[model samples]
Target: MKKILVVDDEFDLLTTWRLVLQLEGYTVVTAANGVQALSLARADPPDLIVTDWMMPKMDGVALCRALAADDRLMRIPVVLSSAAERTPPIEHPLVEFHRKPLSIDSFVEIVARLIGPA
Candidate 1:
């Protein structure tokens, strides 16, 4: 099974995402912020990461940069989501950005496209 790491500061949304991804057949792990997510990734890297743009103790962009700096984590696909006015541009091939208020089907499709079926 593919492993996915989902990072979000909001507890409710995090839980909902975890459940939905798990239901889709992926082994899911979660982190409250980029710091936790980074540690989790270092210890046991996930095949894919889904992160919120605005988070405490390190944002999604910072996390992506950190991951890019590390060869082990750089290959992992990342999906960045934000509700802000504009999404930041990422040059990495494995990184994708999407706006917030995503429908489950759309989100799942992106995930599947990135790392194959959950």
Candidate 2:
């Protein structure tokens, strides 16, 4: 099973994502903020990451940049989720962007594409 790390500050969204991804047969891990996300990633890196843009203690852009900078974690694909009009500069080769209020179909498609069928 593919492992996925979901980082979002909103508790509801975090639970929703965890349930959705679990139902999709993915091994889902969640973090309520970027700091926790980074720590989790360092301890046990996932195959893919799905994160919200505006988070406390370390926004998604910073988290993405940090992950991208680290050679050990740079290869993990990232899907940045944001509701802002202006997207953050997470222009790493392995990162992709997803606008907020994402439909289930689109979300599933992107996740599948990134993690390869789960």
Pick by lDDT: which candidate is best?
1
lDDT of 1 by residue, 1-118 (tens): 9999999999998999899999999999999999999999999999999999999999998899889989899999999999986867665568888889889999999999989986
Candidate 2: list runs displaced more than 4 Å: none
Off by over 4 Å in 1: none
**87-111: candidate 2 lDDT, tens digit per residue:** 8467567988878889888898999
lDDT (C-alpha) at residue 54 in model 1: 97
Error of 1 at 106 (Å): 0.5
Candidate 1: worst-modelled 10 consecutive residues by lDDT: 84-93
Candidate 2's TM-score reads 0.95
Global lDDT scores for all candidate models: 0.92, 0.90
TM-score of each: 0.95, 0.95
